[model samples]
Target: MTTSVIAATALDPRTMAAKGAIELRQVRKTYGDVVAVDGLDLSIKPGEFVTLLGPSGSGKTTTMMMVAGFEDHTSGSVLIDGRPVDSLPPRERNLGVVFQNYALFPHMSARENVEFALRMRKVPKAESRERAEAALDRVGLAGLGGRRPRQLSGGQQQRVALARALVFNPAALLLDEPMAALDKRLREHMQEEIKTLQKSLGISVLFVTHDQDEAMAMSDRIVVMKDGRIMQSGPPEEVYNYPLTDWVASFLGDTNLIPATVLERDGNLAVVDLGSLGVGRVRDRGAQGEKYAVSIRPEHLKFRTAPVAENGGTGELTSSTNLGATIRHRLSVGGHDLQLRELSSDAEAPGRRAAGPVHVGWDADKAQLLVLEG
Candidate 1:
């Protein structure tokens, strides 16, 4: 892996041009014949929390490395605040970065670790110490800066890493799986902390994570990548509810995809035949393909006593699984299995209401007809 410095410029935070916008124009990266990132174009507006989400080998981390100047792109440009920084060194890019591992120096105190960047830049000892302490305090580590990485709790060590990254007052922050090493509880807690801190400071953030829930919870927008290219980019709700392709629908969350034969189309709405589930109108986002599928999230499937004017029909409940706070019910309509998830608290839920023969249905607005990509 290439070594890239976590960074900042010497300019005063208040006086520097505050736009932390990041834009990647037709950027591509390749190692021999294998393309790591393929003609990627992305933009992060200042103060926006944008997340690059995908599974392993999807090139999310590679994109971040390119943006941070850790890996030079094979083609195209990277701009920070509308200015091209393609030739700048990692340090000169002035972007704070945190990684999966906290990477704190075990031999140094938390304060010393946070002070390392400033010290390397030849800042006066008194100012560096003062700034490091304040940065630690900002991340809720007031007096704990005296503790070394090994002496701190996992959450504390994470805070120290955050403090160190923010101590430089960089224009933007890039986090590559920053919470991967922490436990679930700590990860959630830190996610909130990081979001709150980002909003308070109004700093642009480029986050990389494979966790779908985390991306949904934190991002203003999510860029879903697959095979080194973007599959979809939109608000979490939009992407999750209305994925344009089969791969995207399967990636974001649990969804019931019913095969559909497109009978006709009028504008963005298509009237399709779903066989036994009956003919229904669904959202058609101009996807060019010979095959199509209607995507309805498990949570959106409701147990209607009678079929409504939507994609619904009488179905046999094959089995019901109690998933603690939520219940998952498997229903068979015309040999097509559909998964329905309902909250235990809902009185009309399948678990609460007796199973066996039940009418399964979902509103037309809740169903999205997307392309069935090969």
Candidate 2:
């Protein structure tokens, strides 16, 4: 059996300073009149790790390709190191790139693969071999340099690809879902490795991924894109904890979105009636008469001994499932079915056949209220 452990970390200010290396100024791309990226204005800092996170067809990959000089923009400029690179060719961009499908040369060994870029740059044979070996060593594949892509495991091959990209010490690195082929565990391990490598080398990285967890785990800042434009961009904690829009709230993390009308606002707090959850106080209240969205995370809800319905917090235990150290309970509340997660030490996992009117409650301060525009 394997036990997973996660350590808590404080917010790092250094992470914020590393945010704007590559700046996109009104960048847009169109494929035969079909717009892919519509005037995206994004800035990635030097030595910072930023991720372009969005679902499929969200213009994330297209943006990355434009930065890499692989795709042309219909309008606007791509600035690298504060200089426009719109007319520059891919070969002159000085950027490292890693794709999802490995993109390895099956006929070449890992060493040869890593050396390919250096060789193309006209580096001597001996120097290319030395640099390739050193790069492999950085990725923990020094001894496996002779192995071809077919000989290495998925994770190992990925490391080789990473090594190859980093070998050039380019101005910026572009990774388009590089770990998509690896299993969950290996993918996680590689994610950490990539983060550590980027930090130690002080290399700026613009990562493109659809996986929310991956973006949250590795990014210093996250740029959430949708329908060819940036929906939101901020530090992971800021984006996750304080989403400005309803779509941003739902996209970054697990949020129980409930509709509510803004009753009143005093400074940062807004008093809202959750319809069935009684009066709740949430942060970031907008103008009066505006319908707001109440965002509640599962961990914020607690189980109470009293009847939830009687207490005005509507809910009844519909089901419970044991998920290792945590127990998740399904509750039916005011025509809405929601999930509540309680730690094993805090709450016991109820039997499958157990019957009860479970009480669930959450502090008003824990909920986030967003002013709905539409």
Candidate with top lDDT is 1
User: What does candidate 2's lDDT look like per residue over 182-211, in tens digits?
Assistant: 889988887887886777667789999999
Q: What TM-score would every model get versus the actual structure?
A: 0.92, 0.90
Model 2: lowest-lDDT 10 consecutive positions: 1-10
What RMSD does model 1 have? 4.7
The list of candidate 2 runs beyond 4 A from truth reads 1-20, 285-290, 307-312, 352-354
List the global CA lDDT of all models.
0.85, 0.79
Across 197-265, the per-residue lDDT of candidate 1 in tens digits comes to 777677889999999999999999999999899999999988888798988988898888889999889
Task: For each of the candidates, give the backbone clash count.
Answer: 0, 5
- At residue 97, candidate 2 shows an lDDT of 90
Candidate 1: which stretches are off by over 4 Å?
Answer: 1-17, 307-310, 347-355
- Structure candidate 1, residue pairs in collision: none
Report how far residue 222 has shifted in candidate 2, in Å. Answer: 0.8
TM-score for model 2? 0.90
